[model samples]
Target: MTQRTIKVGMLMAKESPDLISLVGYQTSASAVLIGLDRINAENLLPNINFTFTWYFDECQPYKTAGYLTKLILIDKVDVVFGPTCPEWKARKISGGIVL
Candidate 1:
Protein backbone atom coordinates (compact mmCIF):
# COMPACT_ATOMS: atom_id res chain seq x y z
CA MET A 1 0.00 0.00 0.00
CA THR A 2 1.17 3.51 -0.75
CA GLN A 3 1.28 6.05 2.01
CA ARG A 4 -0.31 9.45 1.65
CA THR A 5 1.76 12.61 1.82
CA ILE A 6 0.67 15.05 4.50
CA LYS A 7 1.17 18.76 4.00
CA VAL A 8 2.07 20.85 7.04
CA GLY A 9 1.93 24.60 6.72
CA MET A 10 4.62 26.61 8.51
CA LEU A 11 4.71 30.33 9.29
CA MET A 12 7.83 32.12 10.45
CA ALA A 13 8.96 35.69 10.97
CA LYS A 14 11.78 36.73 8.73
CA GLU A 15 13.39 39.37 10.88
CA SER A 16 16.03 40.48 8.44
CA PRO A 17 16.26 39.85 4.76
CA ASP A 18 19.98 39.20 5.11
CA LEU A 19 19.57 36.67 7.88
CA ILE A 20 19.50 33.27 6.27
CA SER A 21 19.02 31.31 9.46
CA LEU A 22 15.98 31.65 11.67
CA VAL A 23 16.37 31.01 15.41
CA GLY A 24 19.39 28.75 14.92
CA TYR A 25 17.82 25.32 15.61
CA GLN A 26 16.05 26.57 18.72
CA THR A 27 12.56 27.16 17.33
CA SER A 28 11.60 28.18 13.82
CA ALA A 29 10.55 26.69 10.51
CA SER A 30 13.81 24.80 10.27
CA ALA A 31 13.29 23.35 13.71
CA VAL A 32 9.93 22.03 12.64
CA LEU A 33 11.49 20.40 9.62
CA ILE A 34 14.10 18.73 11.81
CA GLY A 35 11.45 17.27 14.04
CA LEU A 36 9.43 16.00 11.09
CA ASP A 37 12.53 14.48 9.57
CA ARG A 38 13.16 12.57 12.75
CA ILE A 39 9.61 11.32 12.84
CA ASN A 40 9.86 10.05 9.29
CA ALA A 41 13.25 8.53 9.84
CA GLU A 42 11.94 6.63 12.84
CA ASN A 43 8.86 5.44 10.97
CA LEU A 44 6.78 6.64 13.87
CA LEU A 45 3.60 7.18 11.85
CA PRO A 46 3.90 4.05 9.73
CA ASN A 47 2.08 4.81 6.48
CA ILE A 48 2.04 8.60 6.56
CA ASN A 49 4.63 10.87 4.97
CA PHE A 50 4.97 14.49 6.05
CA THR A 51 5.87 17.42 3.84
CA PHE A 52 5.81 21.19 4.44
CA THR A 53 4.81 24.50 2.90
CA TRP A 54 6.19 27.68 4.38
CA TYR A 55 5.08 31.31 4.70
CA PHE A 56 6.96 34.22 6.16
CA ASP A 57 5.10 36.12 8.84
CA GLU A 58 7.65 38.96 8.80
CA CYS A 59 6.91 39.62 12.45
CA GLN A 60 3.80 41.56 11.58
CA PRO A 61 0.41 40.67 12.97
CA TYR A 62 -1.69 41.65 9.97
CA LYS A 63 0.58 39.91 7.51
CA THR A 64 0.56 36.80 9.62
CA ALA A 65 -3.19 36.57 9.32
CA GLY A 66 -2.96 36.71 5.56
CA TYR A 67 -0.38 33.94 5.54
CA LEU A 68 -2.58 31.86 7.80
CA THR A 69 -5.54 32.40 5.54
CA LYS A 70 -3.58 31.22 2.54
CA LEU A 71 -2.40 28.15 4.38
CA ILE A 72 -5.84 27.14 5.58
CA LEU A 73 -7.95 28.15 2.59
CA ILE A 74 -5.71 27.85 -0.43
CA ASP A 75 -3.10 25.27 0.51
CA LYS A 76 -5.63 23.13 2.34
CA VAL A 77 -2.99 21.84 4.69
CA ASP A 78 -3.70 18.92 6.99
CA VAL A 79 -1.79 20.56 9.84
CA VAL A 80 -0.21 23.91 10.70
CA PHE A 81 2.94 24.84 12.57
CA GLY A 82 4.97 27.97 13.33
CA PRO A 83 3.86 31.59 13.45
CA THR A 84 5.22 31.00 16.96
CA CYS A 85 4.27 34.43 18.10
CA PRO A 86 0.82 34.15 19.64
CA GLU A 87 0.05 37.77 18.82
CA TRP A 88 0.15 36.92 15.15
CA LYS A 89 -2.23 33.95 15.37
CA ALA A 90 -5.24 34.15 13.13
CA ARG A 91 -8.77 34.65 14.38
CA LYS A 92 -10.15 32.33 11.72
CA ILE A 93 -10.07 28.69 12.64
CA SER A 94 -13.35 27.60 11.13
CA GLY A 95 -14.07 25.30 8.19
CA GLY A 96 -12.25 22.38 9.71
CA ILE A 97 -9.11 24.48 9.82
CA VAL A 98 -6.48 23.42 12.32
CA LEU A 99 -4.23 26.15 13.66
Candidate 2:
Protein backbone atom coordinates (compact mmCIF):
# COMPACT_ATOMS: atom_id res chain seq x y z
CA MET A 1 0.00 0.00 0.00
CA THR A 2 1.37 3.40 -0.95
CA GLN A 3 1.08 6.54 1.14
CA ARG A 4 -1.78 8.74 0.07
CA THR A 5 -3.55 11.84 1.23
CA ILE A 6 -7.31 11.41 0.90
CA LYS A 7 -9.36 14.54 1.30
CA VAL A 8 -12.95 14.44 2.42
CA GLY A 9 -15.42 17.29 2.34
CA MET A 10 -17.89 17.76 5.17
CA LEU A 11 -21.02 19.87 5.30
CA MET A 12 -22.82 20.57 8.56
CA ALA A 13 -24.55 23.26 10.52
CA LYS A 14 -21.78 25.09 12.33
CA GLU A 15 -23.70 26.57 15.18
CA SER A 16 -23.12 30.24 15.60
CA PRO A 17 -23.40 31.66 19.10
CA ASP A 18 -27.03 32.65 18.59
CA LEU A 19 -27.86 29.51 16.64
CA ILE A 20 -26.39 27.37 19.39
CA SER A 21 -28.65 29.09 21.88
CA LEU A 22 -31.67 28.36 19.71
CA VAL A 23 -31.08 24.72 18.81
CA GLY A 24 -28.27 22.67 20.27
CA TYR A 25 -27.89 19.09 19.09
CA GLN A 26 -24.12 18.92 18.93
CA THR A 27 -22.69 18.58 15.44
CA SER A 28 -21.20 15.32 14.15
CA ALA A 29 -17.80 16.78 13.24
CA SER A 30 -16.34 15.50 16.47
CA ALA A 31 -17.48 12.01 15.62
CA VAL A 32 -15.60 12.18 12.35
CA LEU A 33 -12.48 13.24 14.23
CA ILE A 34 -12.84 10.28 16.57
CA GLY A 35 -13.30 7.91 13.66
CA LEU A 36 -10.21 9.30 11.97
CA ASP A 37 -8.18 8.84 15.13
CA ARG A 38 -9.33 5.25 15.40
CA ILE A 39 -8.47 4.55 11.80
CA ASN A 40 -4.98 5.96 12.23
CA ALA A 41 -4.33 4.27 15.57
CA GLU A 42 -5.47 0.91 14.25
CA ASN A 43 -3.45 1.30 11.08
CA LEU A 44 -6.56 0.61 9.06
CA LEU A 45 -5.77 2.95 6.22
CA PRO A 46 -2.51 1.39 4.99
CA ASN A 47 -0.37 4.54 4.99
CA ILE A 48 -3.22 6.87 4.19
CA ASN A 49 -3.70 10.17 5.95
CA PHE A 50 -7.24 11.39 5.69
CA THR A 51 -7.84 15.12 5.54
CA PHE A 52 -11.12 17.00 5.69
CA THR A 53 -12.46 20.31 4.46
CA TRP A 54 -15.54 21.60 6.27
CA TYR A 55 -18.37 23.81 5.10
CA PHE A 56 -21.39 25.04 6.93
CA ASP A 57 -24.70 24.55 5.11
CA GLU A 58 -26.85 26.42 7.63
CA CYS A 59 -29.60 24.00 6.58
CA GLN A 60 -30.26 25.70 3.28
CA PRO A 61 -30.41 24.17 -0.18
CA TYR A 62 -28.92 27.20 -1.89
CA LYS A 63 -25.98 27.30 0.45
CA THR A 64 -25.59 23.54 0.36
CA ALA A 65 -25.38 23.59 -3.40
CA GLY A 66 -22.79 26.33 -3.33
CA TYR A 67 -20.72 24.47 -0.79
CA LEU A 68 -21.01 21.28 -2.81
CA THR A 69 -19.78 23.08 -5.89
CA LYS A 70 -16.79 24.53 -4.04
CA LEU A 71 -15.94 21.16 -2.59
CA ILE A 72 -16.20 19.48 -5.96
CA LEU A 73 -14.37 22.11 -7.94
CA ILE A 74 -11.99 23.93 -5.65
CA ASP A 75 -11.13 21.39 -3.02
CA LYS A 76 -11.25 18.43 -5.39
CA VAL A 77 -12.12 16.21 -2.51
CA ASP A 78 -12.35 12.47 -3.02
CA VAL A 79 -15.54 12.20 -0.95
CA VAL A 80 -18.19 14.57 0.37
CA PHE A 81 -20.53 13.88 3.28
CA GLY A 82 -23.22 16.40 3.89
CA PRO A 83 -26.16 18.41 2.55
CA THR A 84 -28.49 15.67 3.78
CA CYS A 85 -31.44 17.29 2.07
CA PRO A 86 -33.36 15.03 -0.26
CA GLU A 87 -33.12 17.59 -3.03
CA TRP A 88 -29.34 17.67 -2.75
CA LYS A 89 -29.17 13.88 -2.94
CA ALA A 90 -31.49 13.88 -5.92
CA ARG A 91 -29.31 16.31 -7.84
CA LYS A 92 -26.22 14.23 -7.14
CA ILE A 93 -27.74 10.95 -8.35
CA SER A 94 -29.75 12.51 -11.16
CA GLY A 95 -26.68 13.91 -12.85
CA GLY A 96 -27.58 17.51 -11.96
CA ILE A 97 -30.39 17.45 -14.49
CA VAL A 98 -33.55 19.42 -13.95
CA LEU A 99 -37.01 17.95 -14.27
Candidate 3:
Protein backbone atom coordinates (compact mmCIF):
# COMPACT_ATOMS: atom_id res chain seq x y z
CA MET A 1 0.00 0.00 0.00
CA THR A 2 1.23 3.45 -0.88
CA GLN A 3 1.46 5.74 2.13
CA ARG A 4 0.38 9.34 1.79
CA THR A 5 0.36 12.27 4.14
CA ILE A 6 -2.37 14.83 3.86
CA LYS A 7 -1.52 18.29 5.07
CA VAL A 8 -4.20 20.35 6.74
CA GLY A 9 -4.12 24.03 7.61
CA MET A 10 -6.20 25.53 10.36
CA LEU A 11 -6.84 29.22 10.99
CA MET A 12 -7.95 30.00 14.51
CA ALA A 13 -7.25 32.40 17.32
CA LYS A 14 -4.84 30.88 19.80
CA GLU A 15 -4.41 33.75 22.19
CA SER A 16 -6.88 36.14 23.69
CA PRO A 17 -6.86 38.39 26.73
CA ASP A 18 -10.52 37.74 27.26
CA LEU A 19 -11.00 34.57 29.27
CA ILE A 20 -14.16 33.47 27.52
CA SER A 21 -12.71 33.88 24.08
CA LEU A 22 -9.56 32.05 25.12
CA VAL A 23 -11.59 29.11 26.35
CA GLY A 24 -13.55 29.04 23.15
CA TYR A 25 -10.41 28.95 21.08
CA GLN A 26 -8.98 26.17 23.18
CA THR A 27 -12.21 24.21 22.81
CA SER A 28 -12.25 24.59 19.05
CA ALA A 29 -8.65 23.50 18.72
CA SER A 30 -9.25 20.56 21.00
CA ALA A 31 -12.22 19.44 18.94
CA VAL A 32 -10.22 19.40 15.74
CA LEU A 33 -7.38 17.53 17.37
CA ILE A 34 -9.75 14.98 18.86
CA GLY A 35 -11.45 14.37 15.55
CA LEU A 36 -8.16 13.89 13.80
CA ASP A 37 -7.01 11.53 16.50
CA ARG A 38 -10.15 9.46 16.15
CA ILE A 39 -9.73 9.19 12.40
CA ASN A 40 -6.13 8.14 12.69
CA ALA A 41 -6.80 5.66 15.47
CA GLU A 42 -9.57 3.99 13.46
CA ASN A 43 -7.48 3.82 10.31
CA LEU A 44 -10.21 5.73 8.59
CA LEU A 45 -8.04 6.21 5.55
CA PRO A 46 -5.81 3.23 5.15
CA ASN A 47 -2.17 4.00 4.59
CA ILE A 48 -2.87 7.69 4.85
CA ASN A 49 -1.54 10.01 7.54
CA PHE A 50 -2.85 13.39 8.51
CA THR A 51 -0.75 16.37 9.55
CA PHE A 52 -1.77 19.91 10.28
CA THR A 53 -0.33 23.40 10.56
CA TRP A 54 -2.19 26.12 12.37
CA TYR A 55 -2.14 29.91 12.36
CA PHE A 56 -3.65 32.42 14.71
CA ASP A 57 -5.61 34.90 12.63
CA GLU A 58 -7.76 36.41 15.36
CA CYS A 59 -10.76 35.86 13.10
CA GLN A 60 -9.94 38.90 11.01
CA PRO A 61 -10.62 39.04 7.31
CA TYR A 62 -7.28 40.48 6.23
CA LYS A 63 -5.38 38.15 8.48
CA THR A 64 -7.40 35.23 7.23
CA ALA A 65 -6.51 36.03 3.66
CA GLY A 66 -2.86 36.44 4.46
CA TYR A 67 -2.61 33.34 6.59
CA LEU A 68 -4.58 31.32 4.08
CA THR A 69 -2.23 32.39 1.34
CA LYS A 70 0.69 31.28 3.45
CA LEU A 71 -0.99 27.99 4.26
CA ILE A 72 -1.67 27.24 0.61
CA LEU A 73 1.50 28.53 -0.96
CA ILE A 74 4.14 28.29 1.73
CA ASP A 75 2.82 25.45 3.85
CA LYS A 76 1.47 23.63 0.80
CA VAL A 77 -1.50 22.29 2.69
CA ASP A 78 -3.93 19.99 0.91
CA VAL A 79 -6.85 21.20 2.96
CA VAL A 80 -7.78 24.20 5.12
CA PHE A 81 -10.09 23.99 8.12
CA GLY A 82 -10.91 27.40 9.55
CA PRO A 83 -11.09 31.19 9.91
CA THR A 84 -14.51 30.91 11.44
CA CYS A 85 -15.48 34.53 11.80
CA PRO A 86 -14.69 36.07 8.44
CA GLU A 87 -16.54 33.42 6.53
CA TRP A 88 -17.21 35.56 3.48
CA LYS A 89 -13.59 36.58 3.11
CA ALA A 90 -12.41 33.00 3.45
CA ARG A 91 -14.89 31.90 0.79
CA LYS A 92 -13.66 34.65 -1.52
CA ILE A 93 -10.02 33.84 -0.86
CA SER A 94 -10.64 30.22 -1.70
CA GLY A 95 -12.47 31.21 -4.90
CA GLY A 96 -15.88 30.39 -3.55
CA ILE A 97 -18.92 32.56 -4.10
CA VAL A 98 -19.83 34.54 -1.01
CA LEU A 99 -23.53 34.62 -1.84
Candidate 4:
Protein backbone atom coordinates (compact mmCIF):
# COMPACT_ATOMS: atom_id res chain seq x y z
CA MET A 1 0.00 0.00 0.00
CA THR A 2 1.13 3.49 -0.79
CA GLN A 3 1.69 5.85 2.15
CA ARG A 4 0.84 9.51 2.41
CA THR A 5 1.37 12.11 5.14
CA ILE A 6 -1.14 14.76 5.96
CA LYS A 7 0.06 17.94 7.61
CA VAL A 8 -2.23 19.33 10.27
CA GLY A 9 -2.01 22.73 11.87
CA MET A 10 -3.28 23.14 15.43
CA LEU A 11 -3.88 26.49 17.03
CA MET A 12 -3.64 26.25 20.79
CA ALA A 13 -3.80 29.01 23.34
CA LYS A 14 -0.56 30.25 24.80
CA GLU A 15 0.01 29.02 28.30
CA SER A 16 -0.85 31.34 31.12
CA PRO A 17 1.51 32.03 34.01
CA ASP A 18 -1.15 31.08 36.54
CA LEU A 19 -0.92 27.48 37.76
CA ILE A 20 -4.57 26.69 37.24
CA SER A 21 -4.70 28.22 33.80
CA LEU A 22 -1.51 26.47 32.79
CA VAL A 23 -2.95 23.15 33.85
CA GLY A 24 -6.04 23.78 31.82
CA TYR A 25 -4.00 24.66 28.76
CA GLN A 26 -1.87 21.57 29.14
CA THR A 27 -4.90 19.36 29.50
CA SER A 28 -6.55 20.77 26.41
CA ALA A 29 -3.41 20.39 24.30
CA SER A 30 -2.75 16.92 25.61
CA ALA A 31 -6.23 15.76 24.67
CA VAL A 32 -5.68 16.61 21.05
CA LEU A 33 -2.28 14.96 21.01
CA ILE A 34 -3.61 11.86 22.69
CA GLY A 35 -6.38 11.57 20.14
CA LEU A 36 -3.88 11.84 17.32
CA ASP A 37 -1.70 9.19 18.88
CA ARG A 38 -4.63 6.83 19.16
CA ILE A 39 -5.54 7.33 15.52
CA ASN A 40 -1.98 6.72 14.40
CA ALA A 41 -1.57 3.67 16.58
CA GLU A 42 -4.78 2.15 15.22
CA ASN A 43 -3.87 2.99 11.62
CA LEU A 44 -7.38 4.28 11.25
CA LEU A 45 -6.71 5.76 7.85
CA PRO A 46 -5.03 2.78 6.31
CA ASN A 47 -1.80 3.93 4.66
CA ILE A 48 -2.21 7.53 5.68
CA ASN A 49 -0.02 9.15 8.29
CA PHE A 50 -0.73 12.37 10.07
CA THR A 51 1.71 15.04 11.28
CA PHE A 52 0.88 18.16 13.16
CA THR A 53 2.41 21.51 14.06
CA TRP A 54 1.25 23.58 16.98
CA TYR A 55 0.80 27.32 16.79
CA PHE A 56 0.04 29.31 19.91
CA ASP A 57 -2.27 32.17 19.10
CA GLU A 58 -3.28 33.36 22.60
CA CYS A 59 -6.75 33.51 21.02
CA GLN A 60 -6.04 36.98 19.73
CA PRO A 61 -7.74 38.00 16.50
CA TYR A 62 -4.67 39.43 14.80
CA LYS A 63 -2.49 36.55 15.90
CA THR A 64 -5.07 34.02 14.75
CA ALA A 65 -5.28 35.62 11.32
CA GLY A 66 -1.52 35.76 10.97
CA TYR A 67 -1.00 32.22 12.12
CA LEU A 68 -3.77 30.92 9.88
CA THR A 69 -2.22 32.66 6.89
CA LYS A 70 1.14 31.14 7.70
CA LEU A 71 -0.38 27.71 8.16
CA ILE A 72 -2.03 27.86 4.77
CA LEU A 73 0.61 29.68 2.75
CA ILE A 74 3.91 28.79 4.37
CA ASP A 75 3.25 25.60 6.28
CA LYS A 76 0.90 24.29 3.61
CA VAL A 77 -1.11 22.35 6.15
CA ASP A 78 -3.85 20.09 4.78
CA VAL A 79 -6.15 20.99 7.66
CA VAL A 80 -6.29 23.21 10.74
CA PHE A 81 -8.03 22.93 14.09
CA GLY A 82 -8.14 25.55 16.79
CA PRO A 83 -8.36 29.11 18.05
CA THR A 84 -11.32 28.08 20.17
CA CYS A 85 -12.32 31.52 21.25
CA PRO A 86 -15.22 33.81 20.51
CA GLU A 87 -12.79 36.52 19.45
CA TRP A 88 -11.45 34.38 16.64
CA LYS A 89 -14.97 33.59 15.58
CA ALA A 90 -15.71 37.26 15.28
CA ARG A 91 -12.53 37.92 13.36
CA LYS A 92 -13.50 35.23 10.85
CA ILE A 93 -15.83 37.76 9.29
CA SER A 94 -15.68 41.50 9.07
CA GLY A 95 -17.49 44.15 7.01
CA GLY A 96 -19.32 41.32 5.20
CA ILE A 97 -15.97 39.84 4.09
CA VAL A 98 -14.54 36.60 5.32
CA LEU A 99 -11.01 36.92 6.61
Candidate 5:
Protein backbone atom coordinates (compact mmCIF):
# COMPACT_ATOMS: atom_id res chain seq x y z
CA MET A 1 0.00 0.00 0.00
CA THR A 2 1.07 3.56 -0.66
CA GLN A 3 1.39 6.06 2.15
CA ARG A 4 0.53 9.71 1.85
CA THR A 5 2.28 12.45 3.80
CA ILE A 6 0.09 14.02 6.47
CA LYS A 7 0.84 17.61 7.29
CA VAL A 8 0.22 18.38 10.97
CA GLY A 9 0.43 21.74 12.68
CA MET A 10 1.21 21.49 16.39
CA LEU A 11 0.07 24.30 18.62
CA MET A 12 1.65 24.68 22.03
CA ALA A 13 1.35 27.21 24.81
CA LYS A 14 4.97 26.77 25.86
CA GLU A 15 6.93 26.56 22.63
CA SER A 16 9.32 29.19 21.35
CA PRO A 17 10.93 29.22 17.92
CA ASP A 18 14.10 30.50 19.50
CA LEU A 19 14.04 27.62 21.91
CA ILE A 20 14.12 24.78 19.43
CA SER A 21 15.68 22.39 21.94
CA LEU A 22 13.84 23.69 24.99
CA VAL A 23 11.51 21.57 27.08
CA GLY A 24 8.16 22.82 28.33
CA TYR A 25 4.65 21.78 29.35
CA GLN A 26 3.29 18.22 29.06
CA THR A 27 6.15 17.32 26.71
CA SER A 28 8.80 19.16 24.78
CA ALA A 29 8.53 19.74 21.07
CA SER A 30 11.59 17.53 20.77
CA ALA A 31 9.74 14.75 22.59
CA VAL A 32 6.90 14.90 20.13
CA LEU A 33 9.42 14.54 17.34
CA ILE A 34 10.97 11.60 19.15
CA GLY A 35 7.56 9.95 19.53
CA LEU A 36 6.95 10.27 15.84
CA ASP A 37 10.39 8.92 15.20
CA ARG A 38 9.66 5.87 17.31
CA ILE A 39 6.42 5.23 15.46
CA ASN A 40 8.29 5.40 12.21
CA ALA A 41 10.91 3.02 13.55
CA GLU A 42 8.36 0.37 14.46
CA ASN A 43 6.78 0.58 11.00
CA LEU A 44 3.56 -0.05 12.89
CA LEU A 45 1.44 2.11 10.58
CA PRO A 46 3.21 2.09 7.24
CA ASN A 47 0.09 3.12 5.40
CA ILE A 48 0.13 6.48 7.15
CA ASN A 49 2.73 9.20 6.73
CA PHE A 50 3.26 12.18 9.01
CA THR A 51 4.67 15.63 8.40
CA PHE A 52 4.70 17.53 11.66
CA THR A 53 5.20 21.23 12.20
CA TRP A 54 5.04 23.30 15.37
CA TYR A 55 3.16 26.46 16.33
CA PHE A 56 3.46 28.58 19.46
CA ASP A 57 0.42 30.68 20.36
CA GLU A 58 1.23 31.65 23.95
CA CYS A 59 -1.56 31.72 26.60
CA GLN A 60 -3.98 34.37 25.37
CA PRO A 61 -7.40 32.96 24.51
CA TYR A 62 -8.25 35.26 21.59
CA LYS A 63 -4.81 35.04 20.04
CA THR A 64 -4.72 31.31 20.44
CA ALA A 65 -8.11 31.03 18.71
CA GLY A 66 -6.95 33.19 15.82
CA TYR A 67 -3.71 31.25 15.53
CA LEU A 68 -5.63 28.00 15.50
CA THR A 69 -7.77 29.28 12.63
CA LYS A 70 -4.75 30.35 10.64
CA LEU A 71 -3.08 26.97 11.15
CA ILE A 72 -6.19 25.16 9.96
CA LEU A 73 -6.99 27.40 6.98
CA ILE A 74 -3.76 29.01 5.86
CA ASP A 75 -1.27 26.38 6.93
CA LYS A 76 -3.66 23.78 5.54
CA VAL A 77 -2.84 21.26 8.22
CA ASP A 78 -4.46 17.85 8.38
CA VAL A 79 -4.42 17.93 12.20
CA VAL A 80 -3.50 19.99 15.28
CA PHE A 81 -2.68 18.91 18.80
CA GLY A 82 -1.11 19.83 22.16
CA PRO A 83 -0.80 23.12 24.09
CA THR A 84 -3.85 21.83 25.93
CA CYS A 85 -5.58 24.54 27.89
CA PRO A 86 -9.33 24.52 28.49
CA GLU A 87 -9.82 28.26 28.12
CA TRP A 88 -8.67 28.45 24.50
CA LYS A 89 -10.13 25.07 23.64
CA ALA A 90 -13.64 26.26 24.54
CA ARG A 91 -13.64 29.17 22.07
CA LYS A 92 -12.69 27.23 18.99
CA ILE A 93 -15.39 26.35 16.46
CA SER A 94 -13.32 24.42 13.89
CA GLY A 95 -9.94 23.03 12.85
CA GLY A 96 -7.98 19.89 13.87
CA ILE A 97 -8.89 17.91 16.99
CA VAL A 98 -7.15 18.91 20.21
CA LEU A 99 -5.59 16.71 22.88
Candidate 6:
Protein backbone atom coordinates (compact mmCIF):
# COMPACT_ATOMS: atom_id res chain seq x y z
CA MET A 1 0.00 0.00 0.00
CA THR A 2 1.10 3.51 -0.69
CA GLN A 3 1.82 5.60 2.37
CA ARG A 4 0.40 9.04 2.86
CA THR A 5 2.73 11.86 3.77
CA ILE A 6 1.21 15.03 5.15
CA LYS A 7 2.28 17.91 7.34
CA VAL A 8 0.13 18.55 10.40
CA GLY A 9 -0.18 21.59 12.62
CA MET A 10 -1.98 21.89 15.93
CA LEU A 11 -3.56 24.94 17.56
CA MET A 12 -5.49 25.18 20.75
CA ALA A 13 -7.50 28.10 22.06
CA LYS A 14 -5.82 30.57 24.40
CA GLU A 15 -7.80 28.71 26.99
CA SER A 16 -5.83 25.58 26.17
CA PRO A 17 -3.30 26.24 28.88
CA ASP A 18 -6.12 25.91 31.35
CA LEU A 19 -7.29 22.57 29.91
CA ILE A 20 -3.75 21.30 29.41
CA SER A 21 -3.19 21.75 33.09
CA LEU A 22 -5.91 19.19 33.66
CA VAL A 23 -5.15 15.48 34.06
CA GLY A 24 -7.05 14.53 30.93
CA TYR A 25 -5.00 16.90 28.82
CA GLN A 26 -1.72 15.45 30.05
CA THR A 27 -2.91 11.94 29.30
CA SER A 28 -4.14 12.85 25.88
CA ALA A 29 -0.95 14.69 24.98
CA SER A 30 1.10 11.71 26.03
CA ALA A 31 -0.96 9.39 23.89
CA VAL A 32 -0.77 11.60 20.83
CA LEU A 33 2.95 12.08 21.17
CA ILE A 34 3.50 8.36 21.50
CA GLY A 35 1.22 7.61 18.57
CA LEU A 36 2.99 10.07 16.34
CA ASP A 37 6.36 8.63 17.28
CA ARG A 38 5.19 5.14 16.39
CA ILE A 39 3.82 6.30 13.08
CA ASN A 40 7.05 8.07 12.26
CA ALA A 41 9.13 5.03 13.21
CA GLU A 42 7.00 2.79 11.04
CA ASN A 43 7.94 4.92 8.05
CA LEU A 44 4.29 5.58 7.30
CA LEU A 45 5.15 9.08 6.28
CA PRO A 46 8.50 9.51 4.63
CA ASN A 47 8.11 13.18 3.89
CA ILE A 48 6.09 14.29 6.83
CA ASN A 49 7.15 16.10 9.95
CA PHE A 50 4.79 17.57 12.48
CA THR A 51 5.43 20.95 14.04
CA PHE A 52 3.50 22.44 16.92
CA THR A 53 3.02 25.94 18.25
CA TRP A 54 0.82 27.65 20.82
CA TYR A 55 -1.22 30.78 20.31
CA PHE A 56 -3.02 32.73 22.98
CA ASP A 57 -5.64 35.44 23.00
CA GLU A 58 -7.85 37.34 25.41
CA CYS A 59 -10.55 34.71 24.82
CA GLN A 60 -12.82 37.22 23.15
CA PRO A 61 -14.42 36.48 19.79
CA TYR A 62 -12.62 39.11 17.78
CA LYS A 63 -9.39 38.49 19.61
CA THR A 64 -9.68 34.79 18.95
CA ALA A 65 -10.28 35.53 15.30
CA GLY A 66 -7.15 37.63 15.25
CA TYR A 67 -5.12 34.85 16.80
CA LEU A 68 -6.45 32.37 14.28
CA THR A 69 -5.37 34.62 11.46
CA LYS A 70 -1.86 34.88 12.84
CA LEU A 71 -1.76 31.14 13.37
CA ILE A 72 -2.60 30.39 9.77
CA LEU A 73 -0.75 33.20 8.11
CA ILE A 74 2.35 33.65 10.24
CA ASP A 75 2.65 30.05 11.33
CA LYS A 76 2.10 28.80 7.78
CA VAL A 77 0.23 25.72 8.84
CA ASP A 78 -0.80 23.35 6.11
CA VAL A 79 -3.69 22.17 8.23
CA VAL A 80 -4.82 22.90 11.79
CA PHE A 81 -6.59 20.81 14.38
CA GLY A 82 -7.30 21.50 18.00
CA PRO A 83 -8.79 21.94 21.38
CA THR A 84 -10.75 25.08 20.62
CA CYS A 85 -13.88 26.61 22.07
CA PRO A 86 -17.21 25.82 20.46
CA GLU A 87 -17.57 29.30 19.03
CA TRP A 88 -13.98 29.30 17.80
CA LYS A 89 -14.52 25.94 16.16
CA ALA A 90 -17.61 27.24 14.40
CA ARG A 91 -15.87 30.27 12.98
CA LYS A 92 -12.65 28.41 12.11
CA ILE A 93 -14.54 25.72 10.27
CA SER A 94 -16.67 28.24 8.46
CA GLY A 95 -14.22 30.99 7.54
CA GLY A 96 -10.83 30.38 9.15
CA ILE A 97 -9.73 27.93 6.52
CA VAL A 98 -10.20 30.44 3.74
CA LEU A 99 -8.17 33.10 5.48
Predicted structure with the largest lDDT when compared to the true one = 3
Residues 1-99 of candidate 3: C-alpha lDDT, one tens digit per residue: 898999988777766555326434688778878987888788787888878888877767788888888888789888887765656866588544212
Q: Model-by-model lDDT, in order?
A: 0.67, 0.69, 0.74, 0.68, 0.64, 0.56
- Runs of candidate 1 with Cα error greater than 4 angstroms are 16-27, 92-99
- Clash pairs of candidate 4? none
Q: Residue-wise lDDT of candidate 4 within 1-99, one digit each (tens)?
A: 888999997776656444326434577678877987888788777888778877777766777777777777788888877654546443464213323
Prediction 1 global C-alpha lDDT: 0.67
Best first by TM-score, ranked: 3, 2, 4, 1, 5, 6
Candidate 4 residue-wise lDDT at 25: 52
Candidate scoring better on TM-score of 1 and 4? 4
What's the number of clashes in each of the models? 0, 0, 0, 0, 0, 0
| Model 3 per-residue lDDT at 27 | 80
Error in Å for residue 4 of model 1 = 1.4
Displacement of the residue 91 alpha carbon in candidate 4, Å: 5.1
Model 2, CA-based lDDT: 0.69
Global fold similarity of model 4 (TM-score): 0.71
Q: Candidate 5 — number of clashing residue pairs?
A: 0
TM-score of every model versus the real structure: 0.68, 0.74, 0.75, 0.71, 0.67, 0.59
**Of the pair 2 and 6, which is ahead by TM-score?**
2
The residue ranges of model 6 lying beyond 4 angstroms of the native Cα positions read: 1-7, 13-18, 21-28, 57-60, 88-99
lDDT for predicted candidate 3 compared with the true structure: 0.74
How accurate locally is residue 36 in candidate 2, as Cα lDDT from 0 to 100?
83
- Which residue runs does candidate 5 get wrong by more than 4 Å? 14-27, 88-90, 93-99
Model 5: how far residue 76 lies from native, Å: 1.6
Q: Residue by residue across 1-99, what tens digits does model 2's lDDT show? A: 778999998776655554433322254666777888898788887888888888776666777777888887789888878664546553474336222
- TM-score, model 2 to reference: 0.74
TM-score of 3: 0.75
In the range 1-99, model 6's lDDT, one tens digit per residue, is 554444444444334456554423445457669988998789776766666655543234665566566667777666655435546554665464663
Q: Candidate 2 — which residues are off by over 4 angstroms?
A: 16-26, 88-99
